[model samples]
Target: MPKTLEGEIAADHAEHPTAANGAGATSVRHDRRTSVPRAAWLIGPALVAGVAYLDPGNVASNMTAGAQYGYLLVWVVVLGNVMAWLIQYLSAKLGIVTGRSLPEVLGGRIRSRWGRRAYWLQAELVAMATDLAEVIGGAVALNLLFGIPLIWGGLITGTVSIGLLVLQSRRGPRTFEFVIIGLLAIIAIGFTVGVFVAPPSPAGMLDGLVPRFADANSVLLAASILGATIMPHAIYAHSALSRDRFATRRGEQAGERGATGSGGAAPSGATGKIAWHGFGIRRGTDVAPELTPGTATAVPTDTLVRATKWDVTIAMAIAGTVNLCILLLAAVNLAGVEGTDSLEGAYAALGVALGPVIATLFAVGLLASGLASTSVGAYAGAEIMYGLLHVRVPLLLRRLVTLIPALAILALGFDPTTSLVLSQVVLSFGIPFALIPLVALTAKAGVLGRWKNHWATTAAGVAASVFLITLNGVLLWLVLTGA
Candidate 1:
């Protein structure tokens, strides 16, 4: 079960500042010397966006967009990535600077009675919408693979995902990371093999990257592509991941003050009563009883910074390359190559061109992506709900909130083959709704302090937001007017 944002914040406050204990003092001192790697920061966006690339819904949407538009909408993915990079960077920077995640920060800052209520309402909407997509994507994959009824699949997925939530609570971070990484590897292998067997031409690929809006259908597809890429949960995930790293850095190293205090008593400045329920803190004074001229010191801050950067950079490189490869695979092999002109058509093409086995592999990749992306979405929903309302709803309940819509879709007996594609479009429509707060938070120096966005970053972020809003609006108008 996930704790409410208030509950989490309260728990955090109850924690005794590591600075107070002797080990805390040492950690603070060590923090001063530890330097983060230059590359660590780059991982922030990849962690938020990479798995999303694998998202079943995104795969469906991108494939469909490619088939319908014949590579012309490749610009949408490129543009979405550009926007994702800017927004996620802002989220990471904000989390690092404030020592707070997006939801937590917003909870503290938005104090108006009606305004707060409205924010919570909107957040809940985003959560439900995002989760709905995940549930549908998973169900679609199951239907594709085993011929399970879509409704049955949705119910099963909801149950299994809840179990995963419980397991996550007990599992350590390293173990969880390994699981996600392994899944990513399997999906990557599947997609790469499919691409290698039936590659697209380089010339057509070049043509796909250029922007064109020749018709209403093309524009809608473009909007859907962009909307699906920069999802709402991702905005929240970016902040939370940054906070996790920040907390780890703070815990292992030292306080912000110049004092050397890693393992020690809580600092007086820090307001918390951390009970040693499951975790332990080392005393800072034990590092060296007396400062000896010959003693070896802990690593410097620059090194910690560099290490952080390195970690982020490696993650980014791996995630970005995988994403680009997946996009290429679709653009070359599946995009209007045959009479097929939709995502399902692309899969049909894969079956014909590569084989049934390859098509099955694609389905597996979609399944993996759906499950992975949804896990993050669940966490993000819990965070937002807690942040605004301070209620600790169980993970199963959150999953249910998302699962209902997918289940409904199943009852309709609709072809789930297209569910993945539609889910991305749904996400695209929801992006601007969630991103507005994120951009506002990052731009305010008061919220971020020294971590405020630079002019270039701010410009890019604002521009992305404006573009998304306008594009979504235009698409919506076209849909409503039946133009």
Candidate 2:
């Protein structure tokens, strides 16, 4: 596929800093420079990746999980988080080793034009499905908070989220992370109140953390949890985030004379740039500097990978804790309540038990969840679109396009809860498509050199991928047969 113009610009701005001699091209140098301690590299991409786990999809899915099963499916959330950790790590590793995202690498590897086109089509569908959950979550949050109807609430969500994106463009990813992390804190506070107000039996909740579903519906819901938790788009987004944030600057001085990486040259107009920072007040250096001139630090590939792993683990662990908290609160307060499968039902039930003031806290959390996740999903979509199709659209235009499916769902009068659940299931299906490629690329000695996946690491990743695919397929079968 040809690179889009914005893709070329992003590339020029990102990859060519030292290598292009002012012309934009990817510059790779394999010499030692400066290495930072693992602790020093802890703050950027991994924190951003964790935001995917805390989105409104997770809120909705966990709400259902806790209310229906009363902590019985807490194990599923745990499982989902574990899967997310593995998948995200592998995705990020692919980016560091090859300095390209899983989707971009697929663009190079798929070979046949038709095959690549087919991949793009499916990936686009996945992105839209992703947006569906996020948009609905935000809209539902608005409805809950202000008593608006779902339709108008959705429009409001769209407007506010776009405004936030424009703000994020100006503020930079660090600001975006702070905003997301702050929203996550709101969710945690909401749950903290619920856990104290309606604490479940500790022993019982612990038992619930073991992997057993109460029935077939639990199985179907488990898939939704995986979709919301593991998150297909997150895998692609993490790889790109890590690659761009921590790429090496080794031997950059030599590149000042105009040299390119062994990946070689692109045809004219093929040098696509992604206008990721187009709306930002700061230059690319002020945002992600590893890609810009004189900004990246040199380190051994293995050390960089090691530091990244620790970073991913800590951020993802916090995310997993948040998912668990969401499930725990629902189980304590709304589990088994009649008609509590949806967010509103749960809210009403809580209002009855805890009174309106405390119940309103639920809406506050939901609004935060919705707002953060909606912005994130749009950004993830932009990342995938650029990586796969090498195209760039205005941020609002990108946000608007992703909103189409969400609007259609509302127009056709789809049940918001059911639509959210189904959207997660759709995300589950996209996992293997992303994971299989990550495993293959990471295991290639030529691609990663010494940083390639060891046999044990490759085996683990492949096993996890197979297990995820099998479980997703089983969930699909159960849903099809209405089991």
Candidate 3:
């Protein structure tokens, strides 16, 4: 939500040149900050959002696809990745345009007190559900690599992840972004090596990219893979992240200024509500007036948005490639191997088929995904809560809140990998809550102003949402009927 400097702001600045509240007081400050753009700033948000794509849930789901169905369901993974690109792009756009995250917009729209509370509660549940896969996934990797028990491994994961968040917090968002990007590299490297160790048949892999299911059961499995790949909490999280990362300098942290004698209340700028709404932008305005600190230059908002598109495209391409590799490796090395549908079975099979070293490398990738994605899940939880409640808490507290469900599952001694896969199916059920709202809100001119969603974008979003909903319905019916 970028705010344009209007006549009133300049006039106010002229009258109260020293007034902290005067937009004029900040005008020169902005002019000094908007000069140069960095590659890190441009691409950081998408890289952070892309972490969700490489999490443990994806590992289990993609592995299951390759192991159980071979290359038959690879198209579903591609479809889900495309859906993710769309979802993340729209989410980032909403934040960049409106200066408000999706949760903030949703909070503003939900007028009823109880209704907002209900939304918050449901979002919290979804956040916890999201955390289950990440936490369990990392723990499974721990067990695989170090012989740690599931419950203990989960505890270790929660503790280490929280520490990472706290450490990253001290280092600032730039450091955090680089850390996640580094972990993504770890994952990408693991799978790159995996491809060489157990390459899929060229003809079959190509055919797998075509949209066809081998059987009805594969349809159910495709739904599962699709659901696992496109995250619910991620949409909310990405918008907030983009809003934070790409926002103007002093955007939300410094509230709008006012003259001391004026006795007027300026909006709380916390969390980048530049214009409060991006709809109906003033005519002839080229960019947001507020400048990001560091550049003594003024850049157009359109350019900023264009930079975001580049970030999304590049980051998502890497994510999609890594995800495809997961399926390919599974299909080639472990899919038809007896019992390889299980994570443990797959690990053992990988050791037998390739070597223990390759299997361990796979576990290393899983470990990295588990650790990085859990941090992201916690971020999404905090955003959802703050979006609805407007309260911020310590990162550790948020991490602990999100970890409750994962800890409970571990305490019960459930199978870690099984629980992670089931958590993804649960994740599928929560998509509509986040996805439908994103599509609906972004389509409105009131929210996006000149940045309103394209007709084709809206159509595709709705179509995809409906398809997933229908697939979820089919899944539910089969579960109830034991089909």
Winning model by TM-score: 3
Clashes of each: 78, 10, 13
Residues 44-75, model 1: lDDT tens digits: 33453456555665665666665565567666
lDDT of 2 by residue, 365-467 (tens): 7777777677767766776776666666778777777788888887778888888888888888988888888888888876666567789888988887887
Per-model TM values vs. the true structure: 0.78, 0.82, 0.83
TM-score, candidate 3, is: 0.83
lDDT of 2: 0.70
Output the better candidate (2/3) by TM-score. 3
| Local distance difference test, each candidate | 0.59, 0.70, 0.74
Model 2 steric clash pairs:
6-273, 7-272, 7-273, 8-271, 8-272, 8-273, 9-273, 10-273, 10-274, 11-273
List the candidates ranked by TM-score, beginning with the highest. 3, 2, 1
Deviation from native of the Cα of residue 468 in model 2, angstroms: 1.4
Candidate 3, superposed: residue stretches over 4 Å from native: 1-40, 214-216, 247-299
Query: Candidate 1: where are CA atoms >4 Å away?
Result: 1-49, 245-328, 335-345, 417-419
Q: In candidate 1, what residue range of length 10 has the lowest lDDT sum?
A: 273-282
Please say which candidate is ahead in TM-score: 1 or 3. Answer: 3
Positional deviation of 473 in candidate 3, in angstroms? Answer: 1.6
CA RMSD, predictions in order: 8.5, 7.1, 7.5
